[model samples]
Target: MLYQDALLERLESGLRKSLPQWGLPQDAKVSLLEISENATYLAEDGNGEKTIFRVHRPDYHTEEEIRSELAWVAALREDGVVETPRTIPTEDGSPLSSFSDGEATRYIAAFSFMSGKEPDAEDDLVKWYGELGEINARLHTHAREWQKPEGFTRKTWNFDTIIGDGALWGEWSAAPGLTEEGHAILEKTAALLRKQTDAFGAGEDRFGLIHCDMRPANLLVDGDRLGVIDFDDCGFSWYAYDFAAAVSFLEHEPYLPDLMAAWVEGYRKQAPLSDEIAAALPMFVMLRRMQLTAWIASHGETETAKSMGVPYTEGSVALGETYLAENG
Candidate 1:
């Protein structure tokens, strides 16, 4: 469902009308920021206060799931575990507000803006990954120990949910510029990952809820402190997968080994990860690539999809082939 210009304009207009419900003044300005799984807007009030307004794509996330995500984020803030965008409630005291133009129903939520810069891929990635490692550790530690509210639920990033025929992000075969050879190699790579994962097994220490999307895009470099935003994809999965996600689109970077090592070193400072689990890091990387391949295939209109285009899929294939040659 690519949002045509007219559709986006309509949504922005609707958002402006709904602003007052969230305490924004009538003169608040709403502008599109980014579009991925959702259409995000940067809403600024007359006094220059800013907030992020996310209009979720229809049929992707249930109301219950959205509530559950907010609950975990709220808990993280209250516990001082990490700095997440504070979710704002509507006038009715509800976390989510709904809007529909009689065609598609959109769920909207607002959050106080967290300001920071994103780490550049050309920069010292090892240093950035080290900071990310510490951030990932803190989130995982909180996920393991924190008690969930009643009926709390979220998506799962297991093999079945990610690479299976009914994968949430669509099939990798459809990713643009994916060759037959590429698809074949990726299929083999997927099989290998499944086998390794079964062998590694998921013990309580190794699996739990995680911030599944840890790419640089989700990170905000706020001074010396790093702030993580976007819990839309938070779910249960292997703890080591977080490392794979940290290096998500940069798998082909030559300094990948150093980055992974830095992440491991940073993580070990907070909690213990056995060598056996560590050995499966490549499998997680391969898994994350597969998931991204599917995401790109399904989300053709997104800026991420447009920028990466065919080159990203081609790179994934090359990476998959190399991984298989080394480990198969």
Candidate 2:
């Protein structure tokens, strides 16, 4: 589900006016890169320097929240915790800039393009997951120690926030292809998950702010350096949720166990991991799949949701059943 022609035209028109405010030349080349949670565009300046222009979806995040996100990103860069693209400010010196068409307001931000290729899923992803684990460990360490600015606000991905009435995306019951059978299986899985997460508890070490979206698509590889992008979904959650997000849509992959082991090993290289946390990896994976199922149902117009359709929801049910059989 690509954006409608009218919506694309309006966004493009806004970009034409907005680029100059970001200090790009009049002849800058602009094109839509992706239209997922947000509409992202690529702008190439006259000198061939590329910048990513992100047009945030309306009502998802307020200006203060977006600023809070950038504040953490800046802290990560300054502390040398991980490699991330740098945000470029508007002429007015505000990190977040916006324009509204009366119908909807689009908050925009610019980031210098970091050069790298996304890892191929068909190729060896275990090694990539290992690197990602190390990176996530560093980020978690920073999140534990870093001081947040006043008014710092971000959504929490706690159990209730995910499966309850106010689920961040939507309830799993509404996901596509969810028959009575599918719902029953997922509900069981969710109950077990709630029990496990509750037992684990949200102690300072186990739960905190995290990059909730850490899939391969959000990762960039340049030689030995692994760079993470797309902090839009960053917020408070179980730290192991990051590992679950690492394997994201690939939960059903046959090599998942190997990938999980690799991630845990890599993570342990930097931070301490308990056997209890390691034992709960499968639960986290199933939880991530269920969350994605709800996301697909709620965001039916996005290309990912449109393409996933019945197969994705059905797969989630299968995964849920397997998780219950093994973990329940």
Instruction: Give me the candidate number with maximum lDDT.
Output: 2
Clashes of each: 0, 0
- What global local distance difference test value does model 1 have? 0.86
Per-candidate TM-scores read 0.96, 0.96
lDDT of 1 by residue, 252-293 (tens): 888888988988888887778789877888889888888898
lDDT of 2 by residue, 212-257 (tens): 9988888888887788999998999999999988787889988899
| lDDT (0 to 1) per candidate | 0.86, 0.87
Once superposed on the true structure, which residue ranges of model 1 sit more than 4 Å away at CA? none
